[model samples]
Target: MPMAADIFDRARAASRDLEGVTRPAWSSEDQAAADILLGAAQEHGLTTRMDAIGNTYARLAGRDETAPGILSGSHLDSVARGGNFDGLAGAVAAVTALAAIRRAGMVPGCNLTAMGTRCEESVWFGIAYVGARLAVGNMDRAEFDALVRLDSGRSIADHMTDQGLAVDDIWRADGPEIKPANTKAFLELHIEQGPLLMEQDAPLGIATAVRGNLRYGDGVCYGAYQHSAATPRRLRQDTVLAVTELLQRLEALWHEIEDGVDPSAVFTIGKLFTDPANHALTKVPGECHFSLNFGSTEQRSQDRFAAAIAAMTEEIGRRRRVRFVLGDPVGSSPTPLDPGLRAGLLASAQSLAIPATEFATVGHDASIFARAGIPAAVLLVRNDDGSHNPHEKMDLGDFEQGVQVLAATMLDLAAE
Candidate 1:
């Protein structure tokens, strides 16, 4: 079996571009990444193929072909300008684990399928878990048609056309579906994305749940535009200040709730912009827009946050003399990871003498599988910086340890 560092190095080499890991779903870079995984799978004597929605799977055949296969791996697509380890690490570990199992000459009782999923980041489109949803036959036609990529303005179907898949074939009821019944279990290894594991001085951690989120993808605050020189400070309805006030109040509210209720609750403003095409330096800004992302593991906490936002919006509108129009929230609810799988993962870590902690994650593909009733586990390797950025750093030593835990867990579960 190859060293875990070598596997990561190979993955980085495959996606080494000017823009950090620029393998958005359905892009040439994404296809190349898939091909790289496929090559690795075939080299290990595993049959490989891609499904309609571009989920690449490599299977090590078992004695009982009729038995549900053990599925392991993660998405290969990355957010634009994202770090190489975000989604690619898990897929590499999956193949590496399978290769190690093969090298041990242990033929499993059921098939071990390594997968590299697509569009899990939702950076290109507004939808998350696209590839996994399609694989599990949970995607709807309307939802697929409505998913428009921000950069290309093309629907997911348009991208599917480019990939040579019929739009109608994205979701299936009969064959080719990868659901809980057909898959015995799912396991993924990912970078911690945050400093939790590193701060705790641990090399690996297991996720307890993935936090649910409320998102205003296109939120805006409106006020009348006026000449900056002519308008008095008190009389002018500045949209920038209007938005800022609400954001400030919201942050305060977040702290209050987090301190008093759930400490894990969090919120963020992802994008803030003012129309530059029509604005001038001399003019008071008329409109301001920003994305709102709030999340927590508890449903009631999210409910409270939404209520706070609504109340704050009304107050901001009345005080600033501006209108607050928030876009509809879109996101999945918090999903609990499988306890059985969690225990197994913990046992593997302990047996290997690796210190591990369990925490709630913001979002991840493993959560989707867990929500769909498939037992799932997420192994987080300690990293120096958060994911989805160019400067993201993950320790190669920590990743190797994570791979060891994953491989041990797979062997334990696959043993007859």
Candidate 2:
């Protein structure tokens, strides 16, 4: 097998959880994965370093040390029980590409750095791109310190302290370690979270934009519990029905917008359940808990979707005599990738004769970089199963193709 495959196998072995891999942000498993990447970088004669927030970097020096360099790679942390390849594949491919360039005796004009960022998965800290945001000086230190891990109920600051990181210095530092001033471009090689590439029978894809999302993790519908048989349809406040109707209407609005406004618009109700302890199935459900996520590449579409959700919930709640409380929403704006960089990646794909396409991608670390004013691009490899689960499948060959494109793009940017 290739070096990338070996690294992937080793990472999975070290971080294997009950059904999938679990490399929680700033946890031992997360560090272990970074260590593996660092070791591999060292083996390939690259210098390695870890930032204040535990983001790892492996540098392959170029001819001009002072010139702005090209940064690549992806996050190391995974959602709880997530598949191994979701984020790790990109980091591994980055290191492998740098190694390949070194072996081929190719020297660009600027440095190439493979970055393994932490806490890209929001499941842990409920905040996406923690490491990447900090790297670009976009994070608010106060907000970061206040964030609590979902499972541990511990603040992110406590987690960082426990991991032996200098929590205070992180905020006191002059600026971020990786900034737009020093970085020419950020290229991320990641697996397609959806089945787009696989369905297209293409091995790779270049992202055009990253979708921004509105996420409500704590959405609740409340009503008075009543006897199922005794309560008439007009009298009973059915929380379940109210919530279901809200979602159905929202989905319908999404379809409308997708057809006319933005074809990339998507809506999902990821979680919905009635209170199990309150009553049995015989009783009218009194409460429902759910999560709502709406995403689109256009800000206007997102705004329209948000308005529709609010209107629907208010109308349904008033009619059903229920109450809807959607917790504070959190999300980023849609980020367009660098068109020139994307075109260069496509040119490289064409030159290499790799079947590649261009499409919008879900949020990734590359989005953070692009938002920070650094040119960014995302190269996606084909994956069989969707991401954030154990079934994610990226063929080794497909990953190599992504790496080839990434390396070519990095070289193109570095030489300039």
Candidate 3:
């Protein structure tokens, strides 16, 4: 293959390295992975550090340490067997973007920090957004204590105790240092996950906006179970049947979430379980809790879409009898971007003769920064898929093009 066509070359080691690192539930190979990357970063002459949650950061300081660094990173941990690129791409791309600039001897107005964030996939527990959430102070003790892991049947605090970290540490976000770090704007470039660019035949599209996301829905009904022959449909208080009906209703609402009303929206039943599930033990009705995500919209469309979802919430409660509950409206955010930063990226892509477009799909680590009132936007790349799958692959040719685009964009952004 032509060398420039091999876009993912900078990421080949880190991307492939994911397969060798086995961080199965509750067992972290993250320390080892973080250590390896930390060393790689230091050797590259980047300053490095770790967070309480183990978010590994590498810094390329500009002339001013006084200036808050421009931040670019992605979460490192993956959902069990998750493909390599979902989070890895952003980290590698950010580092490579800096490296490319270094190769061409570009200087900058402020320092740059490339982070490989952790605990994003809930691998060891249902600790989604562990790195960014803590960084942003969205996570706290009461919240952590209240969380339950469906697979493990234990409180997140129980998981924390088992892992040797104090649950109370989650509240440390209010401290002085935490706020400064959190103050920096963050940018993350991720795989589109949907077939947009590949189908559109474009090199990239600037994220004009990202939809905020949240989840809540639990179903549990315990009556009794009987052999299919013995159980009378009307006479039996079939808990299993109840849950089944709920699922069908929820799914219909979900379809409506995506098509019936909010066709530009997204919803997913990401995790779920029904207890009394052991086939060998007892035939009892099970309890199930599942997560839901409503996402996707352009900047101009987010409010109308959110309003529609809010209306659906009332209907969901009315339809489900099994103590249905929705989470406190969380992860809500408006469109945010560094106008100066974004303008440079957009104009640079056009000047470079690279294909570019402007749009936004859903929220990400970048959104976390935008919410914190920082300038940020996502940059899309080709040759990526199945963000958390083990067999995931990245197209090297597309990766190279991403590098060039990123390199050019950064050079322009840092231009005085």
- Winning candidate number (lDDT): 2
On residues 106-202, what C-alpha lDDT tens digit does candidate 1 reach at each position? Answer: 7888888888999898778977778888877677778777888889998778886787766676656584467777888899888888889878999
The candidate with the higher lDDT, 1 or 2, is 2
Rank by TM-score (best first): 2, 1, 3
- Looking at candidate 1, the ten consecutive residues that score lowest on lDDT are 1-10
lDDT value for candidate 1?
0.83
Residue-wise C-alpha lDDT for candidate 2, range 121-152, written one tens digit per residue: 98898778999988888887778878999999
Clashes of each: 0, 0, 10
Residue 38 local lDDT, model 1 = 86
List candidate 2 segments past 4 Å from native.
Answer: 152-158, 161-164, 222-241, 274-289, 317-322
Ranking by lDDT: 2, 1, 3
Q: Please give the lDDT score at residue 208 for candidate 1.
A: 83
Which one wins by TM-score: 1 or 2?
2
lDDT of 3 at 50: 73
Clashing pairs in 2: none
lDDT of the candidates, in the order given: 0.83, 0.89, 0.58
lDDT of 3: 0.58
